[model samples]
Target: MSETPITISNLNDYIFCPASIYFHSLDYYTDTLTYQDSYQINGTAAHNAVDSSTYSDNKNILQSISVYSERYNLFGKIDLFDTDNHILTERKKKVNKIYEGYIFQVYAQYFGLTEMGYRVHKIRIYSMDDNKMYPIALPGENPDMLKKFEVLIKNMNKFELETFTQENIKKCSHCIYESLCSFSRLKE
Candidate 1:
């Protein structure tokens, strides 16, 4: 297994295109190489409150807290954890569809917190755009989805840039690393 833990946030990107993660790791000056399109900008804006950790002084509400799962070797900051209700929520700028990637992210957070001795009653995806909440089943309650998530993690552990291929060409146009990726389907 790789010494570096898999980033929880990168789980979504991996589903989009594994190659994107490899290109993203390349050393490049942030200002010169990174592109912040409207979607990214909107996402940042949506996360500003949580990112700044400026939520009300309610002890039951935890925002922008880091979580790690030694068992899964995954780590990342979760958007919110409502201690009073034991609900973990991941906030997205907009959530048109409850993608498998999104579920995987919340599951990782759930597993991390549970391993750390926190009781997680539920997991959800909150869409800032539509002001909606989409609840997800717990890992034990959804064995099929859990199996898929496990397979994804296994694939990530074995990821190799040389052997990776872009299965969904349409994703390339939306990928930030398309300009740097040799497998990008977008025409220059």
Candidate 2:
């Protein structure tokens, strides 16, 4: 509502569930009282450690860090950016499968950096689980995906409560909004 740009995290949330975007836009928060998830805590620690290492002894390896793009209205803290080599890396927690949202988030980072005049040659992801890095083929701001994202944002801006639906019941079951979600399939 304030003309603030939508973040890559917001895009990831929308990919997870359209209803999540709607609920978030309304400032409706899910109850986290019953959960003590360690995954989030570990992720934060990992990110901090990486950030510290980058700015401390290995600063030169990363360049053009924490870049923002005003044109696309997206911002991200890139883990590793080698300007001369034209490579960008995004770190992620361990998971069995790499989701489309992860790829798109990295792509958004690429879009932002390129718009700012950095030629990003490659995109990579560091997985905490294996302590290994995986290369991702650069999508280079695919117009099809951009169009879809724009449509989603436009629809979400309308603020229709009914836009929240039980599209993925399994994911909905684990959602924090499950208890308060009237559009849930569990209610049937």
Candidate 3:
């Protein structure tokens, strides 16, 4: 791999909250994710199916493994890669809204693959809940997308601490980690 890996600023854009990223940067194991992190785990499994589902040979897909970089100070796993494009991970929740964060996640994978000298063709978002996939191959790495991505990762390196918050949106009603999230206290 190159001395510095490709940048990872998209995560904050994905989450749509710079403060949340800031909280994570504080080295806070903040959430204390447990078996309660199952939704996330399930999303990961869905991504694994896509990453390793292989459209062909000579294109080796990987599971959850960090493609780290010392210079970029970036650390995140590729849910899928070794193909024409990369898929960050799968979305397990049954949602209709298009979560752009999936794109950021895929971009991170593509960034790492490119640094490692692989020709990335696209960034795909696979929703296992709906058995759907959206592939975005914008020429050579879209700069705007990447810029926002790196910005988020940069924010993640800030904040001394973080307090979790939630929306009363219908989506969060059945939250698995409700007991763990700080916001859950207020609901109680």
**Candidate 1's residue-wise lDDT over 138-157, tens digit each?**
99999999999999998899
Candidate 1, lDDT over the whole model = 0.81
Q: Provide the lowest-lDDT 10-residue window in model 1.
A: 36-45
Task: List runs of model 1 lying over 4 Å from the truth.
Answer: 23-29, 32-43
Q: Which residue pairs in model 3 clash with each other?
A: 9-149, 9-150, 10-149, 10-150, 14-101
Where model 3 places Cα greater than 4 Å from the true spot, the runs are: 1-42, 47-65, 69-71, 83-95, 137-141, 162-175, 183-188
TM-score of each: 0.88, 0.70, 0.58
**Which pairs clash in the backbone of model 2?**
none
lDDT tens digits by residue: candidate 2, 70-127: 6556666666677768888777666445666666667777877888788989998777
User: Highest lDDT, which number?
Assistant: 1
Query: What is the RMSD of candidate 2?
Result: 4.5
The sequence of per-residue lDDT tens digits that candidate 3 reaches over residues 96-161 is 544556555566666665666666555566665677766665425467866766665565555333
Segments in model 2 whose C-alpha atoms lie over 4 Å from true places = 21-45, 50-56, 63-65, 141-162, 180-183
